[model samples]
Target chain A: MDMIWQGIHDAFSLTIQRDPAIVKAAILTLQVSLSAVLLATAIGLPLGAIVGNKNFWGRNIIVIFFRTGMGIPTVFVGLICFAMFSRQGPLGQFQLLYSPQAIAIGEFLLALPIIFSMTQGAVSSLDRRVADTAQALGAGPIRKLVTLISEARIGVVLGIFTALARCLTELGIAVMVGGNIANRTRTLATATALETSRGEFARGIAMGIILLSMSLSFTLFLAILTRKKNSEVTR
Target chain B: MIDINQLHVSKAGKSICHVHRFHLDVGHRCWISGPNGSGKSTLLRVLANLEQPTSGSCRITAPAIDIVYLEQSPFLFKGGLRHNLSFGLKCRKVSRDVRLKRVEETIESFRLQSFLNQDLRTISGGECQRIALARALILEPQLLLLDEPFAELDLEYVELVNEIMSCRPTMTVLMTSPHRPPESWSFDHLTMAKHTP
Candidate 1:
């Protein structure tokens, strides 16, 4: 109990003093996670809309693939990314290993399936009349898709939030691909792990606090948005 | 104008509705009447091109943009009354001024001005149905398909719809209802018999 109190005290002090290492790690975490989430949303939203709205051949297979991907272990993704970015691997010519870009790439892969599956579920669950209504209103294919996406905007936003939460806190991909090089590639998650393993409880707790605060802010905002939406629906 | 020749719609090898040799010329109003599950709505869907007949053809001789279909329970887009009323015009890429002008005219025509600021969720069923009809009419569609447009309206709205529809003398309309329409409607009736075996 004494140690935990001391650690909490020191963590707050470190955060207040703006420790450069902690700041750097937090910034890198934000940069990498945000980049990963943006890329995932860009690709996932359209693919999800297509898969959810259309009934072409192999759509079920593709949906199944994405659903399976959502459950894939982050460590497994890290291992595959590590192999691919290693010097002797297929994509090694770019020499991206152990860099922030590598971390972003790994996180992007980790976040894609989550966003895709959630968006697909959101869009597929919409009333069947939405598509028919759009069609009946003379919307072309592109316009119809835009309409569907607009109607399912709440679900799409939730998917993005979920992806960002996952990417921000995931440790395996960040530690493995980012290599936790101080000031260069270290992120909050990796830095927390490293500090805790080195018996620096205060530093670990500080990074953990920052990560928790960020996630909590998002969750709070999501709660407010959903509450407002529900009220509007019931009004 | 619309034409249907031996149209058949089925689900899971069970025949639901069939229409044999039906034709409506331009500027004509037709009301389809039948018992429940008689495919009145299905036939309207075929005319709207929202569904494909299991076998046979349904041909509408109008620009696709000039066709509109309203479901039985009209779907109001998630927004204020004005947004739902102007949705179709926006789809056609009408200029903002023209769109606003048409929307205002529709609101006035449908007496929906009172509900302009109201949220779609808070509106009554009759108001929703009228707004949906106004939304469809704002496009000035050459061919309009309405599925049970009068299902949830009181006498006032029923007369309002009848009056508004009576004014569009040149527009082609195909509507479905389980019961006969008002005596003042002047619509040619097409009764769909229930499918057997």
Candidate 2:
């Protein structure tokens, strides 16, 4: 209990004093996670819309592939990225190994399947009349897409929130691909793991507290959003 | 401005609707009456290009004619009444000022001003129908297909809709209903044959 209280005290103090190492890790965590999520949303939204709504020759296959990808191990993704970005690998000339970009690439891959699958599910569950009405209203492809997205906004938001959560808490990808470089590639998850391994229990606990707080904030926001959505539907 | 010949719509190899011959002149109104399993809605949907015939073809003479269809239980996207009214216009790329002007006029005509700012999902079915009709009308569609649009409305709203339809001389309307439309409303009647098991 004393150690836990001491850890909580140190967390606030570190946060207030802006400890450079802790602050850098925290900032990098935000940077990598946000970038991954933004890219995932940008790519996943349209792709999900198309896959979810259209019936094409290979649509089922695509859906199956993405659904399978949802469960892909992050370490494998990290391994593949590391293999490609390593000094002697095919993409080695770019020298992306052990860098923030490499970490972002891994996170992006991790978040993409989640965003796509959830968005696809959301878009797929919409009433068929929504698209039919849009078509009858003379909506072009882009307009129809926008209308569909708006109608399924709750689902899309939930998808994004889930992706954000996945990216924020990811440890394997951050450690393996980011290499947990101090003040450069270290994320909160990776920092926590590193500190705990070095027997620095207080610092590790503090990092855990920060991560838990961030996730809790997101969970609360999602709960409110879901309540609003339910009320809208019921009304 | 539509033609259907030997039109047969089927689901899973089971024929749901069959129309031997049908034609509509420009500005004409078509009221289709049938029993529950007679495919009145399906026929209207096919006309509106919402469904495709299994083996036959339907051709619209005026391909450039803007078309809109309102289902019995109309779908209103997540937004205020005003937003739903302006959706079709926005899709057509109408200017914002023109959209607002047209929306205001529609609200006044439909007497929907009270619910203009309210969420559409919160409104009654009759109000939703009125909003759907108004939304479709604002597009100035040349062909308007309605599927049992008056099934849930009160007599007053039905009369208001009829009046609105009567005023649009250039628009061709197609509607389906279980009962015959009011005598005051002129329409070329088509009866769908009930599907055999």
Candidate 3:
């Protein structure tokens, strides 16, 4: 209890004082996680919409594959990225390992399936009449898809938030692929792990506090956005 | 113009609805009348190309973009009356000025001007029917398929809809109803009975 209180006090002080180490780690965390989430959303939303809205051979299999991927361990993602970015590997020529880019790549792998599966669920749960209505209104295939997605926008945004949360707090990928280099590749998650392992509880708690704050901020933003949309719909 | 030759629709190997030798000229209005479970809605859906016939053909002379279908309970997309009314025109990528002009005209014609700023969910069923009709008509579709357009409407609303529809002399309309339309409608009738086998 005493240690926790001390840590909380230290955290506020560090935050107010604008400690360079904590600030750098936080910025890097945001950079890597946001980039990963953006990439995941870009690829996942359309793919999920296609999978959810259309009937084709092996669609069920593809959905199950992505659903399974949502549960893949982050450490395993880190390992796979490590191999691809290591010397003598197929993609090793770019020399991306132990860098922020490598961490983002690992986080991207971690986030993609989550966004894809959630988006698929969202799109699939929509009323069947939505497509028919769009079609009846003379919308082409692409336009019809846009209409369906817009109707399901709330769910899509939720999927994006979930992916961002996952990417933001994950430690295995950040530690392994990012190498947690001070001021360069370190993220909140990696920094927290390092500080705690080194018996620096206050520092670890500070990083944890920042991480929690970020997640809370994102969730609040999502709530406000959805609330405004719902009010518009009902008002 | 529309033509159907021996149209049959089924579900789970059970015959639902079948029509033989039906034809309607461009700019004509037809009412499909039947009892409940007689597949009046299914036939309209088949004509709308929303459902495939089990073993027949429906040929519409209008281009796909010029054909529109409304279900029994018309769906209003999330938004106010104006958004729902102008959705079709937006889909067609009409200019904002043109869209606004057409939407305003539709609102006036449907007497939906008062409801334009209200939440769509608060509107009555008859009002929803009008909005759905207005949305479809804004596109000026050559072929309009309406499944029970008057199902939820009151007598006054029915007359209002009839009056509005009467103005579109060049648009083809095919609507389904559980009973014969009002004597004032002047629609050619096609009666459907439930398939026994």
Candidate 4:
């Protein structure tokens, strides 16, 4: 217990001092996660809307695939990206392996299913009158889609929030594809792992604290938003 | 003005409704009443273009006539009561001043001023229904299609709605009901088992 307190104390001190290495890793973590989450959202939201709003051939099969993808292991995704981007692999001429782009790609893959599945669930559960009302009010197709999406805005935001959480916290993809290089690809997750392995407890704990606090803040925000939404819906 | 010719609708290969011939002049009111599952809503849906006819066609004489359909259970989207009230007007791109003025008038007329800023989900079922009607009326629809608009409403509201319908002399109204409306309002009767003009 004394050791834990000491570590926590030292962690805050290092974090407040803005230690160069820790800052670098923290920035890289945000950059990579933001990039990946943005890409995932850009791809996931439209696909979700399509699946949620329309009936087409093999839609159930596609939904099944996405639902299954949501449970896919991060390390598996990292492994797949590594294999695709490795020097000996086909289409490896771009040599993206072990780069920030590679890390972002892996993270994007990990977050996509989460965003897609949640968005699909949200849009699918919208009230039937969302479409009917929009149509009766003289809304064109694009306007109707906008209205429907706006009505389901809470669920969509939750989906994006879940994707951000997944991208920011997952270590398997970041470490495996980012290569954990000293200054270049060292995200917070990778840095924490390396520092802990080297017995640099203070630095590791500091990074962990940051990650934990960010995650907690996000969950609290979601809780508040969800509560407000429920009250509004139930009222 | 509207015209129908041998319109038919089906669900899962089962015939739902078949309307042989029907016509309505501008400013006319038609009341459709029938037993449950008699496709009264189906015929209204066909006229509202909410449902596709399995065969035949419905023709609107006015090329640019606006239409609004109100469902049995009033639907208020997730928003403030004012937002729900102004939704149809917003869709028509009504100006901000007009929207505000119209919303204000509607609130006063329907005695919904207290619910102006309240969340729609917080309102009673009857209140929501009134809001739905107010929203539709704000658009000044040339054609109004209502599905059992009086199901859960109070007598005061029922009379209020009838008064509004009567006041709109040029707006054609087609409504579905389980029974004929009160004796005060006169409407052309179109029964579904056999659509008699």
Q: What is the alpha-carbon lDDT of model 3 when measured against the actual structure?
A: 0.87
- How high is the DockQ of candidate 1? 0.49
Candidate 3 — number of clashing residue pairs?
A: 0
Candidate 2: residue B90 lDDT (0-100): 88
Models ranked on lDDT: 1, 3, 2, 4
Pick out the ten consecutive residues of candidate 3 chain B with the lowest summed lDDT. Answer: B113-122
In the range A1-235, model 1's lDDT, one tens digit per residue, is 9989999999999999999999998899999999999999999988898899989999999999989988888899999999999999899999999999999999999889988998899889989989899889888888888878878988888889988988999889887877889999999998999999999999999998999989998889888987786555422
lDDT of 2 by residue, A1-235 (tens): 9877887788777767767877788789889998999999999998998788888898889899988988888888888888888888899999888899999999999889988998889999999989888887778888888888878888888888888888888988888878998878999999999888897777887787777888898889888977776555323
2 against 3, candidate with superior TM-score: 3
lDDT for each residue of candidate 3 in A21-139, tens digit (9 for 90 to 100)? 99999999999999999999899988898788888999999999999989999999998998899897788999998999999999999899988998889889999998888887888
lDDT per model, in order? 0.87, 0.85, 0.87, 0.83
Worst 10 residues of 1 chain A by lDDT: A226-235
Please report how far candidate 2 places residue B178 from its true position, in Å.
2.2
Q: Which portions of model 1 show Cα errors greater than 4 Å?
A: A221-235
Report chain B TM per candidate. 0.95, 0.95, 0.93, 0.93
Candidate 2 matches the true fold with a TM-score of: 0.92
Off by over 4 Å in 2: A216-235
- Candidate 1 residue pairs in backbone clash: none
